[model samples]
Target: MSVRDFAHFIAIDWSGARGARHKAIAMAVADAAGGPPVLVRRQRGWSRAEILEVLTDGLPANSLVGLDLGIALPFADRGAYFPDWDQSPPDARALWSLVDEMCAEDDHLCAGGFVDHPQASAYFRRHGAREGARFAPEGQTGGRGRFRVTERAQEAIGCKPYSNFNLVGAAQVGKSSLTGMRVLHRLGGRVPVWPIDPLPGEGSVVVEIYTTIAAIAAGRTASRSKMRDFAELNAALANLGSPPVAGDGAIDDHASDALLTAAWLRVAAHDPAMWLPAGLTPEIARTEGWTFGVA
Candidate 1:
């Protein structure tokens, strides 16, 4: 859909620090129609609660808010490196096995098994403690142990009892790959989630969000090639106006712009002539073969 069709477009740059400095930079681009993207809001040092409040309050119900954080799978490494290896913890293993069995019964979800090890099982059980168990150690109190075990048993063959907002991408560098995998898993193997390479000298989170939006707008899945093409498209678009940068050696601002370009590209693809500028069309750009749909 075109920008005009969307109620609002949101971009969030997350940060984990104390006070406002730790808050994320959020930008909302409204559908001005035939005009440049309007920066309706730009806030800094926004806490998680503030961000969520603003997001829920400002945007329309149907508006799509593209966040730089991983909103499905919170932990990196798929919780694999939670000080427990080889085997899944008892609670985790049991819960996972149930999930697998349920998936087996349903054709929609994929099936998988956990590592078969006693220590690993114990660790998994301890790690995925229930509400009451969270405060008490795994086996500390009978109430905590029974409650956690019962909860694990209750969800043995389906999704775990958790919320999506808890799943944010890796806060530190050098963990994108692992973080991406966990994010995918948290998405329930359905929606398309792209894992992008980190931007040089800048936080990778922004780049990841940009790439994902671009790919979605293009009606395509992402890859290295598409990302490069997006960069080129951003440069081309920027060239159309007063340059956002002076020389070729400038900080890449393509991340957010690329997402806009991709959104426009989707608009163009639906009605090629409408979104294309004079003498600048998708065909001329040779992006016809660039499919954005998931495999």
Candidate 2:
């Protein structure tokens, strides 16, 4: 029910690159007592398999893990993740299963094929020139907004989340979301992902987190996308009652995100109201998973 219930808190800034290892991935952790969030892992090259290992191999019990990626598409607004498509999955779990099944042959556990699938391709903007395409074209990433209700709600509060439907661009999260689906599929019931699973008293709980939301909550609204400056990062941490992150050394956006989010979760996790958002009904939970700290 509160931060006291969990022993450890973590935030992972995930990457969706095609290589066997990705430098974009970063992780930070903090104690339940809520102190400064320390950068525990900064792997220049982390594979999806390696991350899976991190999740399972000797992880602390009763930990709250926050992953930065949309778990499901905006089914609440579009009526379906892929409207008129015969293979539209019934729920979040089924959707993950579908993505994993579709991209089963991809190398290094990549999910390039699912985004390029004939039936699903219409919904996602692929790589290459957009040519003013309404839907995400094959091999292209930019597209028009196709956000879910929660995403729209997040925008109202200034988070400005892009549709997972958009696979291209620095802001687009489509690739990571798809790849995360595969991770979720493999996680099975080992880690209880919040909103997808009931909030338990004790165990490792994975929840969706938006760094932007955490940033705003930490009073870093001016530094919208990334908190690169050391002063800004430390100020946000101070706002959350977290200690300063050591020296003014170079810190990339991903590292800053994981650090800030980890600190935010340390305090936000104590708010009992966070577990119950207004629109997080059974239907929404199944189709469009809720983002933690969005309510």
Candidate 3:
């Protein structure tokens, strides 16, 4: 489908915190016709379940939703999500299903158990003073530092993407990605997640996006990952012909990411090159899903 097919553009900055409401989660919406991207209010913060309901229940028809989270792991490295594990999933869908099943009983769809699992502990860096230490690998000093081919391809464009396997740092996106897998599991059959599932004949479509790529496309530098200044944020929005961000209090980095990403999507959605990058092969699409604006 084309960018004109959608009536609304929504960008979500998701959090993986194990709580009912998370202030880190931010959402922004913009009309396809062009206007300021407005932040969706959350007086008491936002819950993952609530966001899922908003998308699944009833939303504007033909909306393009951009979610800021890694949809899949670095499968191109070992050609599998979890190498040597008997329970290693073969594809992105299977990996999501396994994670959902493993953390099915956890509250708020948390994936703590998956990361803490004996078999999976070696794959991620755990929190605490002894950072970068890997478990089950027997005295390994550092956690596995790796990236998927798509991530490398994204880096080629000047955007630095964190490895989905690193979970210990402040900038780490591993936790969010793991929790997002559960969300993707529930979003199944409701909205077709781009790359993983083909674009639907009609209705909304969800695509994986890196807010940094969106920020860069909107003329922001790779070094300045966050935009707290109102002028800078609005200038980026103005570059896409979207409305400026106006609010009462201070706008945090998360909100700026969502807002700017929404604006970038408004313009980038029209470009066919983003939808079909040369690296997005049938194999990569099935194993490691491509980020929307990576190419």
| lDDT-best of 2 and 3 | 3
lDDT of 3 by residue, 249-268 (tens): 46799999999998888888
Error of 1 at 162 (Å): 23
Candidate 1: lDDT of 77?
Answer: 20
Model 1 / residue 85 / CA error / Å: 9.5
lDDT of 3: 0.82
246-268 in candidate 1: lDDT tens per residue?
22332223234433543443233
Q: What is the lDDT of residue 237 in candidate 1?
A: 39
Identify the runs in model 1 with alpha carbons over 4 angstroms from their true place.
Answer: 1-5, 22-24, 30-34, 43-45, 74-295
Question: Least lDDT summed over 10 consecutive residues: which range in candidate 2?
Answer: 130-139
Least accurate 10 contiguous residues by lDDT in model 1: 286-295
Task: Give candidate 2 regions above 4 Å deviation.
Answer: 1-4, 130-143, 222-225
**What's the lDDT for residue 51 in model 3?**
86
Best-fitting candidate, scored by TM-score? 3
On lDDT, the leading prediction is 3
lDDT tens digits, residue span 1-295, model 2: 4534788889999887898877788888988865688887634566788778778775688889998988988787657777678899888999999999999899777888898787787777767853223364334455465787678778778877788888878878989998988998888878888888888778888999988988898886724658777887898889888899886856788889999999888888888778888768888987888899978
